[model samples]
Target: MALAGWICLAGHLCWMTLQCRSVSGKVLEETYTKWLKYKDDCLRQIQQDPQPAVGLYCNRSFDLYACWPDALPGTTVNISCPSYLPWVQTVQHGVARRRCGVDGQWVQYSEGELWRDISECEEDQETHTEELWMKQVMLSFRVLYTVGYILSLLSLLAALIILLSIRKLHCMRNHIHANLFLSLILRAVAVLLKDSLLDQHWSKPINTHADVQHILSHRAAIGCRTAQALMQYFVLANHYWFFGEAIYLHSILITSVFLDNSKCLPYFLLGWGTPLMFVIPWVVMKLLRENKECWAINENMYYWWIIRVPILFVSLVNFLIFMKILKVILSKLRADNKQRYPDYKLRLAKATLTLIPLFGVHEMVFIFATDEQTSGIVRLIKVFVAVFLNSFQGFLVAVLYCYSNKEVKAELQKCLRGWWRWMQTCWEDQ
Candidate 1:
């Protein structure tokens, strides 16, 4: 019996270590280590002490999940829920019960495995219903975003091909658009891959032994971490490319003629190279400080800010430049009458619409909103708007700048005429 107890304790310690390392990073890991150490000392003291009146009571021991004190025969022993459980925080004062048989041995399942009843730790019916509803809501959100990304992917790909195929459209402005399209494509792919990886590995029936083992194995897996890092890099790159677009537009309209060079090297560096600066450090910090679980959930705000701050900086800069651009456009419209530039107002409207999504100025609507800060309908609206904008921005940009551009339309018409002439010549030859 003593050997069995020792083995159970050892397994419990390993399980606790794995659970801690799977979530919330180093802080929870340290806390669980201290807790397991304390429990070990208590168990050791119990071993050193004399037996409790020989066979009149159940021996104090650790089960594979929790510790229990000695109890009189034919009685039940209850303890506070184990802190190592993922859901324990939701039921801080919950209890777990273990029954002692009349023979003074801890009860076991009919199949001969030890059982500890933790039903009290489970959520009540109301909470379970709420959880079900939340799951449904989240599933809807996932579907919506997945569809949006798919559509965006197709649109962005078409736009990129069109921009590349038309030689007349090859300029610094078009080069910036191509880079932006590429970044969005990569971002969409990364997000889909990351979500799929998580769903395949981490999404499972909670509290099952198989589920726990599955999570433990994948938590530190290189594939999961690599997916996470790529997601971060591409997300950052997408935002920086938005900045690149804004900067290029601002340079042409506002900056001196000398600054408006045809070379796209600067925009290329900004769009692709700049994300490495933040992503490498963010990866290092996560690996060193909070390395756990596909690097998706960070309890350390500082490490998260490494990725977030740069994106925020990009957004803010783009917004300011957008305002300046708007001011210039409005001033130009005011200076020129309807007779001077008859379609000036129409062109101004199109430019304004195009730049809004390109600059990501729409993000400011939910920039300050967070899961902690908002609840109820406000959070619902924020989430819906965020998902809609984020998923469809690529599509919107493709439509505004590529499919709807007069220059691209002219190029497409020319290509079609040449193709028609070639087809006619081939038909005559036949």
Candidate 2:
């Protein structure tokens, strides 16, 4: 299952990367074309009525006459003045020209060929702007891609550890494992697609603002929505599995009534299938509203909110139910004089308590904290907090429920010991 998950994740990542590259390329092409058109318009306007004396500024300090011999289109020309400053600026039509000489003293360029210098300055400015924009984009891409890649790799390692800990694949852990794998795969793909290949290919020129917006809207609306829905579904399934774990513990530890009910069939379906019913509405709404971007709340915000409210309410209810079951199990253990089980119970309780506030109540806070009236800094902080909390939920569950369990720890240690002995024997033989 873990291997399967990794394969799926890789495939999705490749697809998303390709899609992003394609979209980015289209955007960049459109932008460049628009910029070309703007440049052409400017040139045409200049030809209609040439200015007598155009002053070009260099690096905000030096103003000089811009004059060139030839009318070159789609090329850059470098002109040298008495100044050695490494900055340049241009003004198309003006009389006041400033200049800095080699001595670093400011002077005015009252006479000289102005048109050529202005053209060169404009060309250099455009080039510099493009380079700066590309550098900014590349920096953003590196950070996003690096973080995403590391997380995906670590998730794969965690999955492998889980799979190797058990002898058989069909177990409670396996069910949770499947959900985690699916989530990691989809998220990795989404990240890779958005950050890497697509962004590189699609460089939007300034004039193609509408096209860029259109592409961004479509990608955010459709691509991001699909990814978000999948993530939410997987999260819901994983939590359901945790709830199942609690139920199984209750049956075995407190009472034997549900021993037979702990089988994988019903739990498996409920874990994977139940979220679909809730998710269907969002998917249908997305398709129907197929606007530029996917909105959390659309034209029928009330209707959508009504649907979402129940899901949130149910999650809280299930959390409460899990807590009650946990309390009962712990009480029973304490009465029976089982120290080990009671300690385990305490751990489970702590995990549940932490999660309830983290996932359930925190969401409400996030919603309330967001407002159009809020200052930009406050809004930014609120958004960051919400996103961080939401992502943290999945990771916390994996750590607290699976990695922190004594039973799981023992099994993992045994597996590692065996593997270590095997490696030792092989080394000795060699």
Candidate 3:
């Protein structure tokens, strides 16, 4: 019986350590908010002052029961977070026990009013590394996302202006390109607002997890929520455009059928209109079902999952289509049939190569990244890869589909020569 009890205790301790390792900002914030609320609840008890709750300690152990100084003898409490301040459990001694002392002042930490011990908040090497890794991944994402999204937005706009300026550039593919670019622009704007406004939203510096949670909970605006929805909608829309491109390529390559206006009507509907199938339902669900302050916009809850499910499906379908296109291209290459119709086949092949990567089928590589635990460096690298693929994809599309086109180069050269000639004429007149 003694051995069994020891084994059970050890198992429980191991479980605690597992729970405490590798924390997330959201979970930490939520747990801290709850902890603060608990303190506030206690302070309100029997008309007690708020200050009483700040460092309220009891004879009870910190890890297993009530924290206030006057709790019953058998009660236990859990001590977690950093020794200075913690909202949730971490690998840093996440689960420690504190039992109430019979004499009524929580187990000693000081000679004066400070009162209480947190000596057990020690972390093992693995847990310490996990904590560092989590911080590294977060810092990487924060820095990379801000830089990549902003620059991608600017380049996307430049590409759109170039495409729209020349009369000869108008075609079904350009129409698709225009829509894709617009989606990216809106998504970038939405993400920029969300990221940029985060700091200014709260008056305080948000030094703790609880502070972050509090600001996130209260920072809901109709405009911001709508922008979030719009961003998600457009993000999915852009992916669909990639799927559309794959389908178009598959058609042109396999069947040799050009994308004409009549054939493109369905593609347009699928590209521009299909996202509504997901976004409308998400918006309606957010407005009608969710009563919270944030309204499930930034919260990756039910509505967000609804958006994600279709995107995952769209990604899978596009990948299959892309794979099929590759097979056909490889078969064509092996046959040497391109020699019979060199120019047309070569252009088609070049177009396929240029546009394939921009479709973002490669994003699947990072989809399951967070599902498993890895070292911090690996996580950061995966984040960089995913961020680069998703964020800068629009810029790549703009460059490949519009700027790099032979016709666009000729048009640009023509415009520059005309400007040069006008300058010379002005000089002669002078």
Candidate 4:
């Protein structure tokens, strides 16, 4: 699955790069031709009449008596003239004919005007470099995601092998098997959808005006928006489920009473349903605001602040819960191994040093970083980080807990070995 995802992402990026390059090349050619024609006309006009005044038009203002000398044809020079045109002269030297005002009007000087208007010509060069950088960053992220995906898939596969090849690990205790199955299924779906939809060609190509309109329209853009919203909701739900697993584990270890709680149901509902509310508001705002883009314009910072507040609260709550659990578990473990093994203190220290940085500090940094950004590359990176953390959380938890247990590890190994042997034999026969 990881290999397939990489292949798909690579192909998509190549296609997008080709399309962007083609469009940029055409724009550059057209802009260059237009600039050449304008330059030639200006030069011809200047040669015919040396003192000819031309009007230079810009965004919201215009210069009426802009002069064009034969030496610098396409460029504007300051000119002084009659009652209508006011003039001011700067330092006058050999070749430097520096005059300030043009006609009677005080000419407005803009630094930006002095800069060449080569946006179209420079776009391909600029974007090509940007594209390469994006590709490299994306490739690194894809590799990271692929590793996580493969590990999760392997965990699921190991679980299947346990169920089929052995009885020990498959034994039903406190609905652990059911929880594992559901978690695996959810993780698989989340990874697959994310890898497929948001990977590379997520945004459609804007070839023509109609294509741009379609991309921004209510219907077409809704799907991408919906997918994004759904991904967010599922990610939250995945974490909620992992928290449930921890709670379940605690219940089993401390009380030995597994209370079947459907409390997770409401969480699941909110996780899926609440994001729909955000979507309605977004759609309404998009429609009423009449933006060319599908998503909310986010012109009002207040709207973003409002949206971010709840997410910030939820993240804080989750972080607190995680910290509290870690503290409790470590405290218990330390008390258990107080005197018999002095090295237990060393182990606990190592665990604290490792887990605190991995789980606690990392999550806090991610939450804060994500909340700081609006929509852009920063936001995209945040989404990627969030998804990666959420998807890999279950596997990490399983490893931290089950992998260290001798009985669990033994059962897993036996099951995997048997399954491998069977597959090897079958392959040999084939």
For model 2, state the Cα shift of residue 136 in Å. Answer: 14
lDDT of candidate 2? 0.47
The lDDT, on a scale of 0 to 1, for candidate 3 is 0.60
Q: Which is better, 3 or 4, measured by TM-score?
A: 3
Residue 100 of model 4: what lDDT? 27
Q: Kindly list the per-residue Cα lDDT of model 3 for residues 1-430, writing each as its tens digit.
A: 2132223323333333223222323343444456456655545652553333444345221221223334544456554533323322454546555455555444444553333344454445587576556656666676777777787789889888877887777777777677778777777887777554433332334333344455556343444466567777788888887777777766766764434534668787887888989988988887777634334324545565787788888888877777777777667665665466546567557756675665667767866544344455686678677777777676676677667878879887897898899999999999
Stretches off by above 4 angstroms in model 3 are 1-25, 40-67, 70-129, 206-224, 254-260, 263-267, 286-304, 334-352, 366-382
In model 4, which range of ten residues has the least summed lDDT? 82-91
* Candidate structures ordered by lDDT, highest first: 1, 3, 2, 4
For residues 1-430, could you state the per-residue lDDT of candidate 2 as single tens digits? 2132123322322333332343333333343354345445545654665444444322221111222222123334344431111232233332222334433333324663222223332335575575456555445545544564556546555854686547754465455455545454444554455444334323333232354455455553455455555655655554455445544554654664533554677656655676677667766665666332323324555445534554565556555555666577566667655644547656666755754532344455544333444654576466456545544444554555456757667778888899999999999999
Q: Highest lDDT, which number?
A: 1
lDDT of each: 0.76, 0.47, 0.60, 0.46
Candidates in order, TM-scores: namely 0.81, 0.51, 0.67, 0.51
lDDT of 1 at 405: 91
Q: What is the C-alpha RMSD of each candidate to the true structure, in Å?
A: 5.1, 13.2, 9.3, 12.9
How good is model 2 by TM-score?
Answer: 0.51
